[model samples]
Target: MTAEILQKVASEGLPPTRMNARRLFGSFSFSHQPPYSRLPNELLSEIFLYATCRGVDDRHEIISTPIAVSQVSTRWRNVAISTGALWGTIIITFPISRGQISRALTWLKRSRSYPLSIFLDFRDPSWDWDLPESAHPFRWQDMEALIRLLIVHAHRWKQFELLTDTWAPIFTILHYSRRIKCAPILESISLSRCNAFFAARNATFAPAEMKVPIALFGGLLLDCLREVSLTGVHVDWTTSPLRNLTTLEFKYLATDVTPTKDQFADILEACPNLHSLTIIGRGPQADSPPSSSGSTATNRPDSRSKKSARHVELMSLTSFTFGFNDMDYALEILSMFSFPSIKTLALENLSNVDPPALQSLDATPLLKRLSFLDVSSDATTTPFPLSHIISLKLYSISASQATFSQFFDKLRNLEYLGLYNASKDVLEALKPSSNVDFNSSILPCATLKDLECRDMDPETLLKMVKLREAVSHLGHVSFEFSNLCPTLRTNFLDAGIDVVVQTTAQ
Candidate 1:
């Protein structure tokens, strides 16, 4: 047979191969196969749903992989497009373009009845330019129109994430969404990088500009909000309706204006049944803004303040995470919230220490999972109390032998321990010279099961392996090295230690 005939005969069961075969038009001819035809329709539909729905993570990777898969043939395009599950997701990019928005909406419409998960990330500077000439989708004016379409099938919206550093469009969108009196199905809503709010009477960017009144939302959003994260946003009684929320993440940058204590009180008053909260604050931003002279500095709770915050007690909170540059703010939160049931505590950006608060935190017995990012242990001879922690993660420790030993000693029950930048002093103290032989008796971590050490020296790796052998509870130990530490990767493996090394770049 001829090569073409032979090639065609070998591919008889395959879908039309327009991807690599002859093309009749500029675009590949799509084979008219219903998305469900190639496989069980229901199963294929579920697969499409799995592929399209992503929580708060960026879908840039998922988007690229599927596009590549769909390019295999014309039949796949038909399957891809007809399977509304495949195209139901909404991924937002800033400088929202007219052409892009049009294409995205078209994709959503094809999902038949599947609720949409919209990820509108407005980080691009030129996003405003892409507004439709008459009814710009990127403009706040088009918010109602957008929400109207979404609410028509709101039950299908599994996730809604709107993340941006700008504030102008967020409130505008929220104001329009008030008509959604009952969307008992919205699963995730994230509004991050909030930099706008009318203060006692000054604009952040232009103090003289006339301010717009931001309408408060009470009890309207809680009917179905399961996971929510807010950053740099002010909250008051107006947003109290989100009482049903379970997972909440609050973050503010040091460059942000500190809300009056009453503003903070208003938020606490709303969510009574909150289960998990992650608070991230940049102290530098809080100090940058000028506070009104009349504002009270006394954090002592007044009756009115207590009334607002006390009404919505967080009795169900089980996980608490605090990332702060200032220790005072961290202390304030710990003193206020009596998280008797909290099991996880993650502390990040520990620049300074409030000795009193650290002492109070150590007394807690409920903490189980603890993680410290860039933790500073300069306060005293002992490390912070972590007797209750079962899993510990520490990153960016100073090269102090005292600090390293203190930290390791506290994690007696730890099953997972991750250490980054194994400092020079730590490695040297463990082994001053390569010629010195180490044994299992000198190791720490009596109950360690998984151990990961990043960016450490060969001497340190050897010590870690010996330490692992000494700890009977340790089942696996991993030594990860950056590309610059390839020699150490080889040295540890050659020394009979099982190590998994990953390059810093890849």
Candidate 2:
């Protein structure tokens, strides 16, 4: 009977309504041969929800989740269909086709009035955007049809993500979205064009660049938005200053479209509740912002110094990741904000700053009260005095001896230290600052209880761990997703140090 029910429902979909659920339940209630079959609909519905609730980013999982369970029996099908949130996350990965579009329509309809989380992934690294129209795998009209269908239900969108290589589809979706009065409940959005930087350089076909306006989806949706992640795409920061954002990231933005100095300050001022902020590829434009509303071309770094600095105090910001073109750009941005509660600070790329620039960072408040320090630098000069940091993660392909010596001198209170891609010279540079003598008995990393490295010399690592274990009782030493020799693995374990080596790298 179960097999027969699945065979029938494979091609048929049950309507999500209480009346439809009762009709299916009434039919199944007549049989009581199986004791488990008498389970109440409410209990069965909870089970159905638990089975289907997961990250629905992959579109193929639609068949594996609610759709697959709905075919188990008539009773199961009714329960699965009636759960509205089960169908809320709609993922579209494959190119548009009539059958796939029809399937998506069915999912949307079954979702009913539930808020939606949509993912549209059109990223193909191998396919050249310059390919002729005849060589394209998908028709433009079919893609537009899918976009239009999603736009029709714009008011229901709670989280929307689009990862593509070009801006054609993005413009199409936003053009039609002009009709939506406002997305009052929409909390987050992400638009990423992976090949945007390279695509913009082609003079043969420069896709006309357009700023993401606030009028999109009707009114000021930024009032409720909390998260936004963008790469190689930008909004009109000149006018659309975001507020109440908890997380914001901008990656790989071209020089022409980077945010202006004033615009960047506005974002910092407006979003006092920001938790995580990341900026890569030159950060915000250093020069003055454009005076005119039409021109955003002045969004570039100036050779001279900034005119002024505006100080801001954020009580909630804990994590900040900055990678810019120069040391000055990083310091310029850091000097403007005073984070009394920052816990994590990641500084990348500009670690090779000169003596003056490195010394200038000592005065900035960003280097104080840091709990975790993630720094990539090759400068011989010591950057800052961060004796309060309990953890530090260092990433450098060819770090200097002076760099390691200076870093260890300041981070005396580290309980956890992480190293990535540890080479021979880098590991050798991790020597004790003071030569061993009978008079002095200080050990390296005296307070360190945990150590982590992606790859390292096993003999050297065992020696370091053993030395620390003698003093602070080093509890755990982790080598994530890396191989460990059996001899040293046993030695580490024998020393009562927890050694973790994952076979598959994540």
Candidate 3:
């Protein structure tokens, strides 16, 4: 019988026998698959939801999560397709093709009744072209199509973000969207303009020439809207919905146009529950037309300013940021609000303002984080009474050692200190004198734990670190410099301080 079998194997080619053996092995492997594959469908669906729900801003992940998970096996494919929440976020980019629209429609169908988070990015890279006068680079058709499709689901919009290079598309969408009276579940709306640098550099390019208004959503009100961000886009404060907002940001406003003081105050008054506010003014464009004198009249304090003294108290506001090219303008806006609960304050570009503005800032004792960018001692004289401040950051601030020492003296509870573009005098003040006793020195921030400095003198920094270590306060020190001596780093490590050195590019 063995001889007969061997003869049969020899008669038939070895490939046929080998194919059968491989098939048998594959069947065995499939039957005894990994333990995870044996997980119940319900648990697997939950895992899929968790994985797809995170990192919402990652466009690639958002598009690939459902497809990749479903491709694993027939069972997973069914489970993934059945999970409606996995397809809730739909990001539509500009230059939209038919295929992309189809995919978006499919996602909408799969998402079912889940509230949608729609991000419409109309910042076409082609718009970056420095073309001649006869050419216009915009995909108006594509933009209109995408906006129309999204408007159909207006009631389901949870978050709507429109990013465009020009204001035309934004206005167009808002104009058509006014028909939808209420977005019952809408929570956040962010409308921003791209090509800001281009617009800033080109004085001849006028956004107003396009005949689009700055403010949008005139007659429509989103009762559920909690966050609104507008960048380089104006809004009619009186007509725009500004209630129930928790976060509001306005950046790079038009130079020729701005909300009047009263209008701004009224908007804040309407949002009694606001918690965060950021406003950055647009600086003058080079060689551009000068703004009319009346442009900033509302922000200026005249004899009639007594009528504008009614302040809006923001009791729930905890974070506030104000940046402007004009010191008076910044002060004017600041004078409108009294934030008693503010814990974080950032002042930018108003470096040469009067000391009175710094003194005018309310909630000094409650301030835990303070940042001064491009500030000068000429502008800031009155030291802030920030006894509870734990983190302080200063950037491009030219101040005398006495001024820095005076400010540091106020931060008795400071733990983290960061200095960038610091002047030599500022660095010298931070260097503790070797002759002075650490325990008895009048230096401030006795509770200092972390120190970060850029473009600083290593020797001076080392002295400061030693001083802090002597007082048993130093924990970690990071420096950004062109080069550092290896021995210096080893010395810090020997002192039980975690030292991080980032080499700067030449």
Candidate 4:
């Protein structure tokens, strides 16, 4: 009967039907099912999880699935949404439009039962200036609503981030009033250009009074924090309890109290598991003076207290990058770190008074790569000599042949050299025929494979050739220049160096 029914249905123009009356409502057998239908659900979940986690930049970017995932198929979407872990984050862009806020709220509601994470990125690309006053139709109300929603599930929240130019004072009062509940599971935070506390109090006329009860502003929350990036914010370590943090970076940290290394020691002591740290300004404000010798000590507002209670020791750090605006204090802080496992180090905006600070770093003997940026400081002027650097990248400065020779002579194992400047005299010294015998004292980059020289002049062709020969293992070399006059291009080709010219018109 089933076969006759199937034949009649097929004849009526419907697709051929399988005659399986015995199967009834039961799932089809393995041989009758499509390929991959028999695969275990666990394996499928793992595949989706890996893809979802790949491009995750932070908690915010991961609040939802990447849009491309939906294009796969209906089956994939079912699999993706079924994996509740994939939909656990709520990321929102600031100036939150009604639509965006509504979408984020819906996602948060769906994720409340599971662990939740919220990312608030106030950075808007459309604004010419970063000030909040410039934002059009700013979404403070939307943010307030979102914050209120998260407070209900604060214990289940995994991460919270607030990167904003400013916030309404009412929000601060709400936070202090014990109305702003934070999640116990929250793990990481990043704050940029915000005075979330007292600064908010004076922002407007009907400002909300500060009432948030704090055993600590950031104390209990520090237990699970894995990383923190702060710029222009004061970190109160004494009251804030911290234990297991791995990475901490601070830039332009403005504070009322003078910062000292001791305070830093205290802060580090609080977080015993810290692995990486980048502190941009080393000393107190310029208006403050040194009480001691001819020079003042490096000021760190948090590190000012002399008495050391307990110190946190970081045994897992593998990298450290320091940027200093003040030369004197930068020298002091660089000398303090004992990163036994450090492999990469970068120093930026170093002045003539600052190279002497390099002498303080004696910790990382296993360091593999080092970079110096925007250093116009002269060799004679620098109080310290950097002899340990093997791979070096220099920007915006040219050293005299003698100065460079002296510097490289100390790097016996130096291999990679990248020069960004192409002055005629500097290039001429690199030429083998030039009277400057760089061969004798200069370190031969035996393993050097890549060389890049930018902004060359028409007269520096011989120098390019010499540089190639200087590095015997040269495998790849590229030269980039702009404002290439015809004479310069001809000279570059004549010197046997491959040239790529970029003109303003293009």
By TM-score, the best candidate is 3
In candidate 2, where is summed lDDT lowest over 10 consecutive residues? 360-369
Provide the RMSD of all predictions against the true structure, rounded to 1 decimal. Answer: 12.4, 12.6, 9.9, 10.1
Residue-level lDDT of model 1, residues 296-413, one tens digit each, is 2222222111121221245666666665433333433343445545545455443322222221112111111122222322111111335555665544334356445545565566
Model 2 bad stretches (over 4 Å): 1-36, 54-63, 96-99, 128-143, 196-219, 288-306, 348-418, 422-450, 455-462, 481-506
lDDT at 281, model 1: 51
Q: What digit string (tens of lDDT, one per residue) describes model 2 on residues 12-123? A: 9767677787787755357656875788888887776676655344456644688887898988888888988788877776455567667678889989999888888776
Q: What TM-score does candidate 3 get on C-alpha atoms?
A: 0.73
Between prediction 1 and prediction 3, which has the larger TM-score? 3
TM-score, prediction 4: 0.62
Displacement of the residue 367 alpha carbon in candidate 2, Å: 8.6
- Residue-level lDDT tens digits of model 3 in 293-349: 212322333312234444678888877665544433443345456666655555444
Spell out the clash pairs found in candidate 3.
Answer: 214-234, 215-235
Best model per lDDT: 3
Off by over 4 Å in 3: 1-31, 94-99, 124-136, 195-205, 210-215, 282-309, 350-385, 388-395, 413-436, 440-443, 448-463, 479-506
Q: Count the backbone clashes (under 3 Å) in each candidate.
A: 10, 0, 2, 19
Per-candidate local distance difference test: 0.50, 0.59, 0.64, 0.49
User: How do all models score by TM-score?
Assistant: 0.62, 0.71, 0.73, 0.62
Instruction: Give the Cα-based TM-score of candidate 2 against the true structure.
Output: 0.71
